[model samples]
Target: MAIIKHAARQTLGQLIGANNPVVTVPDDSQRQYAWTKKEVDTYWADIQKFRLARESGKESASEYFIGPIVTITDEHVKSRSLLDGQQRLTTSTILIAVIRDILWRIGSPEARSTASNIQRDYIARKAGRREPIEYFLVLSLFDRDFFRDFIQDWNELTGKVRGVEDPKKRPSHKLIQEAYSNFESKITAELSSYSDEDSRLDWLDSLYECLIKGLVFVEIQTPTSSDANEVFETINSRGKDLSTVDLVRNFLMERSREDLEKQRVNDAWRVLLDKFDKREEIERFLRHFWVARHGDVKSHSLYATIRGDLTREFDKRPHAYTAGAFAAELESASIRYVDLIHCSTGVDEFDSALSEIKALNADALHPLLLAASEKNDYAQLQDLIEACLSYYVRWTVIGRRESTLLEENIFEVAKEFSGGAGAESILRRVCGWIPDNETFKVDFEEASIPKPSQARYLLEKVEAKLRNTEGVDELEVASSTKVHVEQIYPQQPNPELRLDEHDSWVHRLGNVTLLNGRKNQTNSNRPFPEKVSIYEESALLVSSETQVFRLWDSQKSRWRPEGIIERQADLAKTALTVWPSSSQWQ
Candidate 1:
């Protein structure tokens, strides 16, 4: 008899008022209020559309479906724990509060009566003369106090509370406050445009009508947490409806039995989220974390893989793999994750190497770095970072493989390292991922870098390696002062030099060198004699080194196609030295 599970389609007003003596509460297992201004704007647009269609007589009064909400009834407490659709539910309650506040400001007798009804019916309810009005939507434990205070102040005609200084410190509180403030401001600005009470009354009436009769949701009430969770996952998995982080959070919290353990898990989860500016970064970090331990799981399969891993581990070793234990580990790893992102190793060499890797956007290697941070020292980490950068340049940049292939290789190496392989073994694994010398040489001869930033970075490194070789392995060149890449063979062939044949070499690494100033732009496309004098004044080793090289005949020193080819060959050799193969380290 499956306990006769029941579901029904209900209006927004009905759902809010559905809690007679009990409240609809988002449990600790659920995420906090996360609807941004964009979501609020979308809801407003829908409201406006519904109103316009009705007032203009374009359509009859019709129900506007928002979405479904899943809840499990708690018989002992007489409350329903909201398992899904908290974002929409919370935002709608905020919308109602905004409407009530606007009507209260109108101050007329009719407006006062209408506002009182709204507060009584939708926002809160009073059971007796001495009883305080209870709210309809009770947020999770961490956010409940703040959200209650906000709604209470609004209902009693008190002014709104000021926002907090640091939103990330208390994300749930901050989000609720922001939602109320944004809705109020937007509504005030909108109403200021109307000149008469009649127009304003009509607008208020329209909002009330739409809220009560127009917006609808399919509400499913389950008898147990497991059943409610199943419904939530099924509904959200079909689309980008729920975030992967939220899914994992629910999975973790629902499994914990004791209140203290649940609270610990909740606190750790909040700490992990507070470190990032956007929720998407949390999802990205989880993917990287999982890959570092388990290997390459596809983006779409990340949540499933994590869920599966956690379930299996819990079954095998419940004492070690409980939700609270998992959360503590995640929080610790998150600290390291932040350190990786900001390059805050406190060791200058490691910091500089990591910074260079960050500039290259070598996100694929992050899992490898995370694994290395566990056992490797600063110098060892630096070597790994340098090798990874060189591997990325030769394999992905020069060899020109798809970026996905790089991600796959990095994930594979990360799994090996995490599975008890030594740092040397991981280094060898990555070195093998790089293209062979013959392949790299062929690609290097034909490679052309047209992007200005990449060109500057390459030339700057080469200059640093050539000039400051004693103890300063890495130099922090001021970004504003970096020299421009000068194509010795003019990019747009100069009629004066009659060098049209080597126009293809304009963006090639061998054909480019950094000029000290804008003085070289003035010497654009000049013949070999004039450009040579410009090159002579330069401080770059590449330029100064080029000045001494004679032609193939050992007769003339000039910039020719042959000269470009020879310089590129020399630069290629230097690159091989700068970005050494892992075998060389051995």
Candidate 2:
């Protein structure tokens, strides 16, 4: 069995250099490393976290773990090959090169000696120029082109930056690269005292080596008499793994037994996937959505982080991101969201008992999440968050939470609409609400009709928030979603009938009204004349109502565009109530 332990514990460094450690790379190891700009950015960001851990007194600066350097044993010789950690090694090489080049340009005596010696002995040559550049290999299961470009581009950039007789620009990638460039410039510009190249190189190398050695890795040894696939899932589940969506996608082919029918889970890998024309894009969008959906997670660990696991070749295959996102969005819209909104054609009319009971989670509303400046006195937002997630778990764990438990309570409606617990949890906590633990179901079920209970829940929340606003009152407030007020006067030219485009102001919320019973029904799902007839017949509804959520006027159809614009004049005033003024969004 392959032993798993710290590299330091095994005294690996001495073995690597002692008596010439003969290495043989597997012939199959010729695969290209294909990390892209996005990958680099993400990796560096992770490194930044480690850098912080060291800086903030949590750990010593010299005691940081760079990463695992894997070496395999063959029948002939113990071959040292870098199974994973490659980027940092290569970047450190570049740093040394840059530092050396800077010293060389400045004509420092030992600059060339120190830099060349290290490069020849450690970074590039594996041992030295006297030794052939074989037996020691560094690679990952990444594309070859990626590794080449990353190494060469980094090398060229560092070389040029350092070679400048008088350096001008600062390297922007940060931490290592920035520090290297900064130190290079400082030495080249003024420092004339320190000529100790070995110490200098050693200082940088030691720092770099410390990071590499300190990086702790949970060695994933291939266990005998066990499923490799199961281990993959287990290793990833501890927030150390990839996103569920990603894991779902990567192992979709592997999972002969996923709950395919329930979440429309199969659709992710099936029909909807084809809609995306590109493979790479599908992978990226899927990864992004999956990552973003996971509250504050920022790793590709989530089961290969969606399509990020996809090969560069496949990623470039076509419409990958577009396809993945579209499929996921469609399924979500049809399912998870449907579960959230909880549609029910047969909904009870607005009743006091339902409203009173539903008002329990008034504090969990999005308006509070969005508008409230989080204070220490904030009620257990965490509890409320848990409550939101609990609604999802209770409702969405099975397919189609819609028209059932979710719709039964307005509480579920609020939870679902604001992206349920996960989304609101982030919005609330980042905005300063303490968070609680509750596993929210990321998927949803279908809804055929609008859940009146859910609608009322949201409508009430909007009303309450609006009412609480300065100079606003409960009676004056109204609520709605993307539902719009249609202009009774049909807009656009029916060519055969010879009509002009109805001008400015139809499909707007202003030409709308929150009406009672027959009045709303009579005007809805009908045409202009019928709506006009209903409006005329319902004088009590018109005169008694302070706000008109829906409105109609037939005069615009025959008149010019100005006539329609004039009809919409009152809507401008009404719209002010629904959307509040904001610097970023109106």
lDDT string for model 1 (259-338, tens) is 88788788877777677656656777888888888899988988898898899988899786698888887887777877
Among these predicted structures, which one has the highest TM-score? 1
Model 2: per-residue lDDT, tens digit, 1-586?
A: 2443233322223323234353222222211222334544554455546545655665455244444434343334344443323344444444445554554454455554554444444333434537644312243322222222322222322333212333222111222344445445643443454466555545444434433444443323232212333444454465322334434543433322234322343454433233333334334334333432332223345444443443342356544433444345535433322111221212232122122323332222322222211221123233333333334323332123452333234333333334544444433332231111121111211111133443333334334443465344345222234332233434332344233432333332223223333324334545544445444443222212323323333454332334334323433232233322221120
| Stretches > 4 Å off in candidate 1 | 1-4, 17-23, 36-41, 58-61, 74-78, 100-121, 124-133, 145-152, 155-158, 162-167, 170-193, 196-201, 436-438, 448-460, 466-574
Report model 2's TM-score to 2 decimal places.
0.33
What is the lDDT for 480 in model 1?
38
Candidate maximizing lDDT: 1
Candidate 2 global CA lDDT score: 0.35
Instruction: Give lDDT per model, in order.
Output: 0.73, 0.35
